[model samples]
Target chain A: MSPEATAPPLDESWVPIRVHGDAGGLEVDWCHLGPERFTAPFFDQTVEDRLRHPFALLFQHRTSIDALVERQRIRPGLPVRGLVFHMSRCGSTLLAQLLAALPRHVVLSEAGPVDTVLRAHRELPGLTDAQRITWLQAVVAALGQRRHPDEEAVFLKLDAWHALELPLFQRAFPGVPWVFLYREPLEVMASHARHRGAHMLPGALGLAPREAAGMPTTSLDEYGARMLARICEAGLRAFQHRRDAPARLVDFTQLHASAADLLPELFDLKLTADERQHLREVAGRDAKNPVLPFEENRDEKARGLTPEARAQTERHLRSAYERLEAERQGR
Target chain B: MSREAFERFRARVLEDPTLQSALQATPDLATFLVLAQRLSAEQGCALTESDLRDALDAARRTWRERWI
Candidate 1:
């Protein structure tokens, strides 16, 4: 773990997907993502497409994670320009889509391998915070390798529960302007009631006792609302901890004058007039499925909330919602 | 594929974008595997269908389930 050592270059197309114990030793498993553009809604979707072929599978590579660390030492990848964290079922995908509309940007939407690295500490016992930070940097460098010569910015849109690990990400990439995007709790809750993400399950994450205690022993919909409340609060608390942060607290609703104001200032991004128009087109499509047009009925998505889900959201998440709504006027 | 042949074939494929694209363009696994084995044999890294199946099964992800 010295500062001066370096390793030979590894191909950027074969990105690492898993970091785990391999026959009692730690290793990284990589899949070849080829040269295709990341136009998919999620990073995993892109990898899954590759997996549907023999080319990406038969040639998978396995090696010590240190190999990537050393490879990164030889060639440090793009520095992360911005981070996007969101409560699930929120508009984070739309924001990520907008950013990825141009070829100059590399946007990783809820990349699973990055999530595995972020949570590696839970499984790899006796791992120190320093090691974790170094590993995080290495992993990010591996993910951010320049696929296109014109690539300028690398943005990572993290999963909802990742907000709970804000301290870790902030520690890994300090001074990187980030935004915590969220929606009305009932809307988020309603969306989850229809199709629940793994994090919404009663005990899927084996979350902290405090989070577990907060969840009711009722329906999964109520649990999803409470879980969203916890995630939203975590992001707000992390941002509030450092008011000087180059960050924004964006609500789902456009009530905030600064909502979706975007990162020309914060992320140090520049867009031409044509690029801006292209992003407007990107935002008009569905975040999860870009082939489909954006559903105009924003309220319709939340209209299916069950009575119990609505009650739980109001009971548990109303305060957090109000406090965040106040951010609009303050902005 | 034997370990040496598999490794050699992979090395060759990694350096050949044309082959990569051809294999990627296959409509299904059967066609892809046939093209892959034929390509390997052309390069002196010949492998049987069982070897390809074994390699797919040995992958960490559920390649069999994926195909199924």
Candidate 2:
């Protein structure tokens, strides 16, 4: 037998959910996500919801990266409408949720398969950049497959950590409009302090080249601040690199006030009256958990923030934050 | 529950989009299993509900244990 196994050619009924193993040993886990739109807050939530389906459970398929790539050759998926990069806790979730509310849009919020392919370089030594951009493109294209006749556009809200891999993502989908959404440094830090993301930990994601320089990040607060700084700097660097790149900076400070108009204008999306009504309803609920009502907690977070953490955030993120603000305003 | 019988039925399903579409277009599992078993027997490969249940249960187990 060959070193790898080939899976069945993807039909419209089956979609890949995860990419397992490394370059030498690779496998793709698939489930029937067809006939079901991803309206949940996150990709996993959508997958979890489908767990109760007989089709999803009974007809699981496993394949190699080759099959994913092959499917792309046979049939391409919808062209991307936008790519969203965020500094976590920003209005990124809100943006994704709003997009999902529209019956004509397919929103993939922080999908795992995309992250795995983007980080393929980390699994193999001596590789400076992504080892499998082809797989990345294929997986994304596969997910963007139109399951509903009304599906008109696809939007991907990448993870906060993906800000570091901006160039790599840009390379995969050139000419696609992208946005970098951020909030006040202090507010974002406080939110993470309460319920931290794994990216906030030192070397949790196998230290990027920047953190590997021996910065000696000791505490969770410092680590989180430094990581935030890296994301800010990376976003700024990408913006300055390509002045003509279709990139926008979304502060999301007054997200509720500005998003209704800002989003469609920035992405050049035309919304119908029904879609507008749907957006209003979606915006009324928690973007991350639709079960709860939406509430703005910036004031609460500021009040709860420790003086020490605020100082640490300033020490690390002050310059980057100011530069980002300047760029957002200047543009 | 012969493996050969199920394999034959699966092969025909893969080759026939119309059959696959009919199966996918079924409204519910009870209806789907009835259609699937009937089609399996029509293709000169009879597969009982027990056979499909065992196969799908095994597939579900493998999928649940898949690495995310």
Candidate 3:
């Protein structure tokens, strides 16, 4: 493909990269590659491009943490100590907003480059471990550039799919502390049904063919379980395989109930009286935002999993939650 | 660290006071060095290895006492 043809249309911010894989299946447009090339193995003109043409708008927004890190304007010598991983539609957004309200942290929400990297990895078969490491390095570099030299800590909230890339992130930022947020599976499914429609539900979660059509299917409940399992698994496995290296689990319910009381202790930061007060007020006001409203339409809820089929989902989640508690207690 | 490097680091760190306090209280050279090296690498820029190494040493000592 010629540079122009391979290149996304000038106005387009994301160009689809075809992915061939076994578990996720071979597919076109599985992931996106940015126009800007930072490293050799990850992005190149022959396969990709460097800044020869004016930067084609590759993403709608500059939320790519990697791109921000490349800007090199971020202050140095700050203590960025937190990463938040979550299951979709849990209260993660609210938690992130609460954390961002703190005076001492900069929270980057659901940045795109990480997702792009994961998609590329999954789709493009035969990527060597070294190549994978280099891609991850590129992502870390992107995040580093986005740090403001003046900010002491940077907190990143990633999409749930990022859970699959936890091992890579653990290697990239070895010692950084992290927390995973999860809600009850039924609630998560209900919220996802309400917001993402049929698009986000994974197929193996017992989705019907019509419901699964045109949707990205992964083992949602199974993957969610594995993500929790990785976090709770003891020692270096938790550190090496879990995305939130030095990980902790925060129940969505608990976070909603006691965020103000818990955050300072967990993050090792002292919030000023005013900051604490502000956080409480924000939490209280947002509590009514309806985290997982029940869907009155049975058809909507039934799209992915039949009532009978969903029993397995419940069993999986319960097992995962139990394992997480066990891991958290150092069992 | 050079004045320029320090300033860049300072600006990002100071964006949040809690981080500022943590850095000020700790002032570990190793942590700063690691961060600086990582930042430079990410930006596709280069820094003198000696400078990064010095900062890393300082940060490690400080973090051991404070965080670890």
Candidate 4:
């Protein structure tokens, strides 16, 4: 075989599937998939759109960050426009999907690879703070490759726990606009009580052993409420501390009424009238289950909260929630 | 990694209550491997470290190849 034929493909189309550290150092798993695979939803592997794009295991091996950096130096990616940090189930997926509906926008909604890198920082072998932040930048750059000429912006909807890691992200993407999407404590608690998110479960978000020690495991409802409060507290504390960063506190209530106009202005998204119209249509559908029509879930969640549970949430999380709400209202 | 090896590991984790509790209590890769190794010993499955690593890599590859 010719030397060229035996060589691995080094193209911008390939993106990092996962980033982790081994005994040697940092390594990234890369897989090549066409841009269309990204443009469509991959939440459901059974979906026709997703099934059509069967990504081959390119080169049958992983690549190092040095190789990715060399590849990126040849073909740089689009700069990130904004970052979305949410308290989970607070219309974050909706906002991300809305932006994704627009053809010119690249919105990464709670991308697992990014979340894994962020969560497994200290756990990964030989990962120092400096190297971790550098790796984060490289991962985002690889994911932000502008496959289409019209692609103008790349936005990240970080995993909710990432709200706690705001400082790290700020250092990675300096001057990028960000927002913390939050809802009332009771509302968030009720939603979790109905169906617990992975983060709401004990130790799911990589909580320090000391932090998890305080949680009351006997009552799953109380445990969930306490865990959620910690997440909200972390977000509120970060938002308050990073006052100089281009940050905003967006209430869930405001999103339904004005995200179409507000997000563009806040995030500097220059959407055309047609794009706005399309976004509105996308917004009308359930973000998680797109086939279902969007229904008002707040009222249902409020009704679901038991009086005792509501009191428990109020006792544990209300103060932090109130503080966040005050920030959202510009108090 | 063979599909059956992956499926067996998943099934054992799900069926063993003690393993599930240990997993939830300490949700890290190190702890997970330790639990899987114990289970593999009892089940007589040749679940080597390489097998687990290959399983993780294969799972990641499948997720990227398919998921959005």
CA-lDDT, candidates in order: 0.73, 0.78, 0.46, 0.67
Q: Compared with the true structure, what per-residue lDDT tens digits does model 4 show for residues A213-258?
A: 2644556667766666777777787778875567888888888776
Full candidate order by DockQ, most accurate first = 1, 2, 4, 3
Residue-level lDDT of model 1, residues A216-269, one tens digit each, is 456666667677777888887887785434878877664123222454554666
Task: Residues A4-55, candidate 2: write the lDDT tens digits.
Answer: 2555766766778877676475567777776888888899878867755654
Candidate with top lDDT is: 2
Q: Which pairs of residues have clashing backbones in candidate 4?
A: A42-B68
- lDDT tens readout by residue for model 3, A1-331: 1011121221212322222224443222212223222222122221233221111111112122223222223322234577777766666666666776664555556644445455554345775555555554544343433223344566667666565456666665677887777655556665553454222444432335333332322555443333333333322234335543456677666776677777776666677898888887666644324244322333454465546335635654556555655655678
Q: 2 or 3: which has the higher DockQ?
A: 2
Worst ten-residue run, lDDT, model 2 chain A?
A: A1-10
Q: How much lDDT does candidate 3 score?
A: 0.46
- Worst 10 contiguous positions by lDDT, candidate 2 chain B: B59-68
